[model samples]
Target: MSSDDTHVGLHPDDLDLLERLGRIAAVVDPVPDEVLELGRAAFELHRADALLMSLVADAGAAVRDNGAATASHLVVFELGETSVEVEVARRGEFVRVIGVVMAADQPYAGECRVSLETSASTTTQTLDDGRFAFERVPVGLARLVLDREGDQPMRTPWFDAR
Candidate 1:
């Protein structure tokens, strides 16, 4: 199916699901046919059963909820033979981080770091694409630090507000 074909134009079902998921203003962009094709091929080649299919669907949901299409900015990092792309967004009282990593020409292996810093606190570590989120971040000046170790660490020059 083409991307345009996948666009359902705000159906009732779509609105219901989005509301139930607490995502009212989130935009629902159509998934590309290429992505669906890749998912189907992966399932067929690897013999992924129903459980795996369910997991993939859940992951897709999370990706949608994390504002993949309207991401504020994407941080790209090249670290020791690996390239990582991270999507960042401001969600409610915290900043949501989502990312995918691939070793040059290889399938995504899922490795990256997302750090949020305030004057009083700082945290850092590698995280799965669906896993990194900082909560209760004080409403003040803060910085987002994306570190990939071997690569030059990137800092978002301390912006005010959550």
Candidate 2:
């Protein structure tokens, strides 16, 4: 076929039809508010040169015989020579998170920011020993973001913090 015979652009009718379909879909199956909020949060967390930490281990939250008074879990993430170990424990109606960062190649010498992000709140701690903690955090889906000077930020995958 000749180049002139090929049509690459969509007709005005096609565009209108797509718009109508989108409107109908939205009305029929609307996105949940939580989903939209999560989407926006995820978008905002994006970093072009950030290092995405990989989950290496997760020890499920253990329930104490005394009930929710003392439940705890551990999760670990690593990327190259850097590893982050997080331990989340139940504290009253909320939770407490303690973590330590270990980087063999590049030590976290100076103050580093460690952020614990949940659906409800975002808490940050800055320390030099690669140690950090967050207290009275609401229980929900959570992720960790580690930022060190002169280094790429590291983010952990979202995990349920029940």
Candidate 3:
């Protein structure tokens, strides 16, 4: 090997074949730079958006639900100048959660979505009077993300989900 010489221990035909294959693959199934950037951003957003909320009431805690006999969970999370209150209850095998996102003086008047850890598309709705609900959600890890008008986003901690 000399400073100006460059070679690998492969036949010339082999090198040429490898180069052609690489070119073919690139054209056949190319990953664009924009797609790669989007993928990276999506992953970062998942972490950055999961703004874990503090649990005020845990599952199985003694909580009354509108004078109902069924068991229920009451969880609350307070963010700076904003807060979310969630009540988890069983409608059947699935879970139903009624939640409200309130602020000290500026409640969110936008959309709220419930996402399960195992899901991609989520149950979404525009927050009406600071209230939202998730119906027939499977029993598992779930979180709530709020998108408010003219305000930063907020997400709740993963609840018992059931």
Using TM-score as the measure, what is the rank order of every candidate, best first?
2, 3, 1
lDDT of 1 by residue, 46-138 (tens): 212111100111111223554543224455555455454545555454455555555675634454575666665676666564245555454
- Model 3 over residues 1-97: C-alpha lDDT tens digits? 1111133576777677877887898899898999978865664467484455566656565445677555577888877767888888864456778
Lowest-lDDT window of 10 residues in candidate 1? 50-59
TM-score of every model? 0.34, 0.66, 0.57
User: Candidate 2: where is the Cα deviation over 4 Å?
Assistant: 1-49, 61-68, 105-107
Model 3 clashing residue pairs (backbone) = 53-157
TM-score of 3: 0.57
What is the overall TM-score of model 2 with all chains considered together?
0.66
TM-score of 1: 0.34
Residue 57 miss distance in model 1 (angstroms):
30
Residue 153, candidate 1: C-alpha displacement in angstroms: 1.0
